[model samples]
Target: MYQSDITQFLNQLKQQKPTLEAEQRRGRSLLWDKQPVDLDERAKQQASRVEQTPYVYYQNF
Candidate 1:
């Protein structure tokens, strides 16, 4: 069997810390994993948004 340096190091690291993978999953869930979006709520927000003028410096008299 052949193993790259990174693979071997990772295997050793996992063996040293058995709970490392679980900790990684927990951290990832905290930041990357998210709940499902509400499409209806999003649509309502979009509908309520005010349109911006093309030129902000000039004021309409």
Candidate 2:
């Protein structure tokens, strides 16, 4: 949860806060710095999964 990081940030705020750009980069790094989703792969995953029953268990072997 970045508790320590938040504490450090608050402590720094008490003394000297960082610049707006620096804060923006830090916050963005925490949440928005992820790989983009691939539409094709997502579609493949959604379409590829199907449920099928191949065997009947009611009769004796």
Candidate 3:
């Protein structure tokens, strides 16, 4: 029981504070920005309606 307690204590300590380099390599990036989904939807709408006899940008606009 005493040996098991010591092992558990060591494991808990290791988990509390991980090193900085490991955190940086696979961590959440602070610089990431995503483009809006609406722009893609507008592009697809434009493409499909391109062949229509009357261009209808306002209907979908």
Top TM-score prediction, candidate number: 1
Highest-lDDT candidate: 1
Where model 3 places Cα greater than 4 Å from the true spot, the runs are 1-3, 20-61
Model 3, range 1-61, lDDT digits (tens) per residue?
3568889877776688666546665464544544557988888898888455475666665
Give the alpha carbon lDDT tens digit for every residue of 1-61 in model 2: 4569889888778567547668889999999898889999999998998855566565455
Clash pairs (backbone) in predicted model 3: none
Tell me which of candidates 2 and 3 scores higher on lDDT. Answer: 2
How good is model 3 by TM-score?
A: 0.25
Per-candidate TM-scores read 0.69, 0.34, 0.25
Colliding pairs, model 2 = none
* Candidate 1 lDDT: 0.95
lDDT of 3: 0.67
Higher-TM-score candidate of 1 and 2: 1
| Model 3 lowest lDDT segment of ten | 25-34
Candidate 1: pairs in clash? none
